[model samples]
Target chain A: MSLHTEYSGPHAQARSGPQVAAPPPRNSRHAAPGAARRFLSWLDLKAAPYLLVSPYFLLFAIFGLFPLGFTLWYSLFDYELTGEQEWVGLGNYSELLADDQFWKVVVNTLAMFVIATVPQLLLALMLANALNKRFRGQLFVRMGVLLPLVTSVVAVAVVFTHLYGRDWGMVNWLLGLFGIDPIDWKAERLPAWLAVSTMVDWRWTGYNAIIFLAGMQTIPRDLYEAAEIDGASKRRQFWQITIPMLRPTIIFVVLNSTIGGLTLFAEPMMFYGGRIQGGSDNQFQTVAMFIVEKAFSNFQYGYASAAAWLLFLMILIGSAINFMLIRRIGGRK
Target chain B: MTTLTVRRDTPGARRKRTHRGGAGSRIWDATPLTKVMLAFTIIVSAFPIYWMIVIASRTNSDAVDIPPPLLPGGNLGENIVRVLNDPDAQFLTGLTNSAIVAVSVTVSVVIISTMAGFAFSRLRFRGSRVLLLAVLLTMMVPIQQMGVVPLYRLMVELEWTGQLKAVILPYLLNAFGVFLMTQYTEQAVPGELVEAARVDGASTLRIWWNIVLPAVRPGMAVLGINTFMITWNDFMWPLIVLAGNPTVQVAIRNLNAQHSTDYVMIFTGTTLSVLPLIVVFLVFGRQIIGGLMEGAVKA
Candidate 1:
């Protein structure tokens, strides 16, 4: 708005003019210091705002903008850590498109995204509904649900990895009680996906629930009261009113989960005991792991850069799809 | 506001009101089933952490025992000692490094965000609106994933690959922190207060120091806590860059890799890594929860 220059420019001049004109004979001795003070204050008014905000911008330009641009540049070249640098010009992208392992990873990533997100969001919505009720120890309940979020992701992965251990693990042990054979969580595709999905959901569901609860709190109480007066049951009102009113929050949560879910790295990586391959068969390898594996393990810097860009595109597509889907939820009366 | 009054009403009065043709309004009062379901959710939320502790406290064979030890064992102290003394794990260094990095990043991010937030909210300047929008756009780009290759190259060129600075510098500027604080400052510090301070001849920095920061202290606390937690738990970047000298997360990965079958030792290290955060969560649980929900709505 340039409000700073407009206000400070003429205003400072006007104030200083009056001060100079009205200065007493005795005060004339202090005129120099007064003018210096005015100049310093003027500088503070004119420049402090920029100074205050520069750190984030400066740091972002260096660390954020540069790398983003550099990644694009790196993706265009056939650059490796130790090998000769050559121009690939989207060759990496084409190779990635045809690579069977790459497509498998993409499927694995999306499958895990759905496997993790569908139940996680639904559970969060229900949990939010439950927490929205007026209850004793509400704060206690919120803290308890959000406790998982406090633990490190690796720690969560490590614990779950042990629990899902094929032999003598708690999960398989529980399954044995159900007359089902012990599942190899790491060996098979479906079981591995399920294992990683549980880890994701366990860590994030409560956090999302809290966000949903916040959104629920903002919906007017009168809406519910009016629905109730119209003889609508609680369940009916929830379906008709709560779900529709929570559309924005649903979109927010859905987009966040999409980006987060597609970037599934630490959990699956730790699930396979820190192997970037995800498993021996690559059953649960994510695009993120693939990027890391290509760049660091194989030193294919340029190829990894292309894969990273594709991952970004995947997130964009994922978010757009989820956004449209969420928009459809309760949008049609 | 009406809801606040309704919530404050005596339970007996509320029950009486609900009884008199307000059966549907009883929705707000959780049924016993909801309570049971909520209890189960809490258990599900907390059990992994509890299980981690149990395994940490048990012997190696007891950890992978048939039923899997559900209760804490007497080996906790011994295991902790072993983990601390283990050369390969470097449990103590990881903790210290994580603490240093988390604190450094948290303090820097909070201060930077507050400064930027105050400016964006209070100080009217050229392009402020556009700059704020740019910050929002940056939040959508996952720079950590997108920038890994170049950032790694930069770190290697600068000889910062193994140092904590490489991990610290990139995360110092958090777009989310700036955005959160901007929203919070707008709501918390009134425009009239800034005008009044300006009329009183307070310098812009003074107004920020005397008025904005004090008003936004809660926002700062929220941001600080969240940043601390995220930084403490950050894995991918640290795993990539700080390979030999690692944070708690990468260290846990290393421990898992080294002792893939030594369940108790690995569990012990995991428990130790998460213990500090658990203590922080327990102490500041209320503020963290309140701040998070508040930030969620405002954001």
Candidate 2:
């Protein structure tokens, strides 16, 4: 496209050295055409795509790939605040592997994953199906469903914390209406997980629902019509038609939520605070929180990096397993 | 909407609506009622938000009532005053920080991704295929997981530990934006037109400016809003990076910590944080979904 143009604007093409505009084709033919003309066109074709892709590569190498290598390097050495260092090599990983707290964190993560993710996916699917049908006030309802994903986790955590509070909390107040007493939510493990998971399900269930809704919307109206002709009821139609058709999106949300769930932080950290360092006593201290405590509270950067790597390995392996599960589900005949 | 408004107005529209809504439709679908199910879902889903507003408008004493004030009260001003007086009251500062960072990151991302996307999808260049794949792979890497340790250390070393740039710089060129822009550019842009512009004596930049950008402006709008929201709502990265300075999200964290004793103030502060996002939704909600679906289905 740089055949000819005025360079007067901000988005204008940058100049390549002292070259003036390439001479017009007529002038070029009259002047010194053959080899140079052939070369320019080839260069132009080659250069365009190169110019297109360089930005991502340049940025990724510096920011993406380099940081990963640095993380590995940091994992090997005993980095500290007191300016002392020693070669740890595999020592950090060994320590993490043997630690009961590390395993507890893993179990905590998986438990929360099962609790929060399963319900989130199920409710999202149900809501999306319900929403796909025509209705009164549909726009308002759709927008309402999405309100939570738009809010920050910190905001969500605070709002839910208020709800989960021991005294005067809306949750406890509601339970009192059922003749139940106020519970000290943050003091216990199960209550804390329930508190954090409630926040997760509230915020994300709708986000996933929107994705499912989008998937449902595109299932081709004829698919449902065909299902109806086969004498399928609405319930049967949902499982047979909607669930099957929404498979890819179901997988997308699963993988996306798995990543988010495994790296869970903020919501739980704020929920448990000092309880996190208590290890076994803390039921909800996921691996990410465990790493955060190692780095921030204990000031063991090398140990923290090891913990982080171990967690990363778990995510990679879990993600691979999830890939298999999704494939099996998606590939179902 | 037209159906909704015109239906009841027609004496006959109610009968025609038999194929769809109303109590009888549920019977046709079966006694396993749909509206009842939907209403239940809405109540369970919407109660927390309703409860937030209810809690935010009452005093600590009133907030702790046996049957809490389900109705809105006149204590919003007092709640705000208490929330403001609290030592962790960085919400106003955080609001501005969020605006600055989200806007800057969105602008940079939009401009760069659009240019890169245009180049990949329309203007053919060497390794464009390989590079697009690389960009896609980048999207799958879950950067927050990978960047944690290095990013924290880098922030510390650069003396950006408590600065807005700590959050802003790392997020500028997100992979999702690149992927989104690629989809938009491919559809909105065409090769023949780009070639024709070049043939008509426009420079590469001129082709992008005069031809490509106008075609992709709708996309730019979507990408801009999505990127803004992503940056604005980011939690873990900013939590680790900035120590003293608080973005709106980080400020909400600080507020939660300091106002641990006062649920009403925390509720009020959270409500304040949500207000900007609500504005974001009102303005760009329709286009944001379209953008997200486009990226997802295409990928």
Candidate 3:
């Protein structure tokens, strides 16, 4: 990384600006006599680099940064759609702190994250191990795993909503074959959480498995051979070699999963039969869903902005912990 | 513990020992347990999609049957036609709207992200490091849900509330896209190539057009497909901005709401919505999988 940085310095200097390139040596063989050519050459050298990079910063400022800062500003007032704005001065945050619904939504989000991410990552590792082995039809199996990832989250929710149907759903029917009663997946809180997490897990496990598989491939094959010669079983090699070598990848997956899982919106919304609210009783409503509900449905812009800030703070804190965990793991070795 | 020291044990002989056994060893090495586990994974992976097909292929009555037609039924064509002709959902118009928005945003995202990525990777400028760090830091912030209120207000204030541009404009600049392109350009277009071009009096734009762009073609292709898919499948932002003018996802959601009791139409609409991506994935599975895993590993 440092080498690349140092390498780019001189290259950047060589073509830093068109003004420098416009002045030719007194007896240069190639010289542009026309003002147009010099101007074009100058634009190419000095202006193009900045022009190339300006779109992102420009759009990001207008759409990304402005809206975020506006949210912070909007949180300070009791603004609602089609209503007169009034200065509240941290009133929304105070109300949000005391609101039971806000706490419930936060807990619901955390529950879904824990429920979805734990098994998802574990199964991803196991699947990656299975995939890393050379075999017939390897490409076919690999593609099969990624099928869910490529499929849209809304589509997955649509299909799983059907599967989790009370009476005629495939899952319940399979359970019936084993003499278990049908489950009203969406009506009950635990069942709804499970159903939503199942959708999350199904979509992500394969994607993460591919990542883990990539990490596993980076492990030298000779290590497995050495372990084999020492009479270590495949399981032992996985425990002793694969897991430790995969620390960074594991950290990456966990942090990503934490973020993705916490901002749970689409699945819960769709799972609740296309309603924005999680259920009839708000059993499975996540913080994101609540924010949307408050902003659009209830038209409480200030309150929703406060909730959004809370969500951002949770993400910031969670990410910091994950970052520190990565550092600790890195420091240990 | 000795395994950690093994890298030094045979530094020069590493190449000789890489392929530990012959092809015969691979054929006889698999155990029953591993095979069963792999089979289970394959089934789990493919079954939901297969189930979607089955549900979409069946009629309303057949779909609600106790066994629920394990295999796809014979009503696929009829169901698809019904779904397209359904007046309430506007599937045909939604398809056109989705195509326009997705393609427009994808083209712009590819051009902008590639240009910015090339500049970041190859060009030296003041505050380049800080700018790169800013881009990466933005990735950690999930702003979609949080920013909806202000974004909605902005669109309304600009009289863009019901316009597709309301959805298209905000998403053209993606942090991941820039990061991916930068990483790819670094490896794909070597510094020596840029240095050589500079020595030959090639301007920055000239080098970018003649050298860097051609070198990163594969990366551009992957980024294009990824962007198109993300734009096409985007729901919440489009849901808020587009309002009554529906994209494909909004159309599918509308179908579900209007035909709440009719599983056939809902399933059919979803199947139609997912068909293009499925086809794209099938055709370019290798490149898509390779690109995604490459990005993940690099991250």
Candidate 4:
């Protein structure tokens, strides 16, 4: 990382503003002229680095920093749709603090983060360990797992919505084969969460598996070799070696999943019927859904901005906790 | 626990207990067991997608049969036609919208990131370190967390509520693409090459067009497909931006609104929308995986 970072420093130095390189040290036989040429090249090189690196900064400032800085400014003001506005001075945040819907959305978002993320990570780990073994048609299998991840989430949500139906649905049909009754999956709270989480699980588990598999492949064959020589069982090897070695990968998936899970939107929104009110009576409505609904449906730009910030703060803290947790796990390994 | 023995111990000892390691011949070893376990692994991994395709192919009636149809059926074409022709189904339009968004985003990402990368990796200018650091720092910020409110406001103010460009334009400078190009540019392009071009009195713009671009095209190919797949599959920003416009995914969202009565219609739409992405992956998946691996190994 340091080497790449340092290398870019030199890269920037070389491309600064367009000074044509001084004509190759002509009459270099003259010591004084040669010295002056060397000085000129050094100055040109110094200026070159700046010109090269300028675009990234300029663009980042415009696209990245400016929008973010403006978000902070907007959060403090009570601005409405169609030019209605006033300075709120933390009034929005105060209202959100007392808002029960906000808390419900927060809790619902957390419930999803726990309900979906942990099991998803575990499944991905198991799948990775399975793929780490040699197999015929390994390429086909690996590519096949990626199908769900590569496909649009909307399509997956649509497929699962079919599967989750109480009647005329494949999942219910399968359950009926075992003499089980069909389930009204999206019409209730818990079932809705399960339905939404299942969609997430199907789409993401393979992606995390591939990430884990990539990490596992980098573990030398000798580690497994050494464990076998010690008479350790394969399960023992997995627990002792694979799990510890995969700790960082686990952390990576967890962090990615945390960010993804908290912002749960389209899947649940789609599952619950994406009207102004989502879920089975807003049971599955997430903070993101709330923000979008508030912003567009009601045109409460001030209120929506507040909700967006509240969610943003929740995500920021959630992301911070995720980072802290990952670093701690990584430290253990 | 038994699965553990499969990975560690040999395949035999079923008929008679050859308990220990050296009790068996060395060559007879773990081959059969490895092959069996490997087959199980692959089957389990590939089964769900196979199930989806099979389910997608079945008629609405056969699809919900008590046993659930494991075999592919002949109704896929019928379902596809129904999906396209349905009054409420904007699937074809959505597909077109997806293509437009994905292509535009990919082209812009590749062009901008490449140019910025070349500039960062090849030039000398003032505040280069600070600017480069700023770009790198944004990588740490999840684009969704802090930027959503402001970005939404900006789009709304720009009167881009139902525009594809609303989604396509804002997230153009992908943190990963910019970072990737910068790294690739550093290696593939040497400093002396640019200097040589400069000393020859070639303009900086001319050097960029002729010399630097050729040096870093392979990187662009990897980044291009990645950007396309990413923007194409993205759910959130598009879901927000395309609220009224309705992308393929949004159409799917609307399908869910009609209840399970339209199961066949919905699956048909799902199949059509996901098929192109699967094709894209089949074509470029290896390169995408390779690029990710390259970055991982570097990190």
Instruction: State the iRMSD of every prediction, in order shown.
Output: 5.8, 7.4, 4.8, 8.1
Docking class of 3: acceptable
CAPRI tier of model 1? acceptable
**What TM-score, to 2 decimal places, does chain A of model 1 have?**
0.88
The residue ranges of model 1 lying beyond 4 angstroms of the native Cα positions read: A1-40, B1-25
Colliding pairs, model 3: none
Residue-wise C-alpha lDDT for candidate 4, range A117-200, written one tens digit per residue: 879888788777777664567667777666677777777666677677676677787788899988888677777777788889
Q: Judged by lDDT relative to the true structure, which candidate is superior, 2 or 3?
A: 3
Can you write out model 4's per-residue Cα lDDT over B69-178, one digit (the tens) per residue? 77787878777887777667577778888889889888888877887788777886766567667676676565654566677777778898889888777668687788
Worst 10-residue lDDT window for candidate 2 chain A reads A3-12
| Full candidate order by DockQ, most accurate first | 1, 3, 2, 4
- Compose the digit string of candidate 3's lDDT tens values, residues A42-69: 6676777788899989988987798899
Winner by TM-score? 1
What CAPRI grade goes to candidate 4? acceptable
Q: Mark the 10 consecutive residues where model 4 chain A has the least summed lDDT.
A: A1-10
Backbone Cα, N, C clashes tallied per candidate: 0, 7, 0, 26
The stretch of ten residues in a row with the least summed lDDT in candidate 1 chain A is: A18-27
* Per-residue lDDT of model 3, residues B1-299, tens digit only: 13223322232353464466785345225466767887888799888888888889988998888987888889899999999999999998888889999999999988888999999888887777888888888887787877889999999989998788998999886887888888778767777768756655677977888888888887888889889988898888887788788999888888877888799888888888888889999999999888776665555
Q: After superposing candidate 4, which stretches have Cα over 4 Å from the reference?
A: A1-22, A25-62, A79-83, A179-181, B1-67, B86-88, B119-126, B144-149, B186-218, B255-260
Best by DockQ: 1
- TM-score for each predicted model, relative to the true structure: 0.91, 0.86, 0.90, 0.80
Compute the DockQ of candidate 2: 0.27
Worst 10 residues of 2 chain B by lDDT: B1-10
lDDT of 2 by residue, B52-118 (tens): 7777887777777876678878898888777666667677787788899989988988887887878
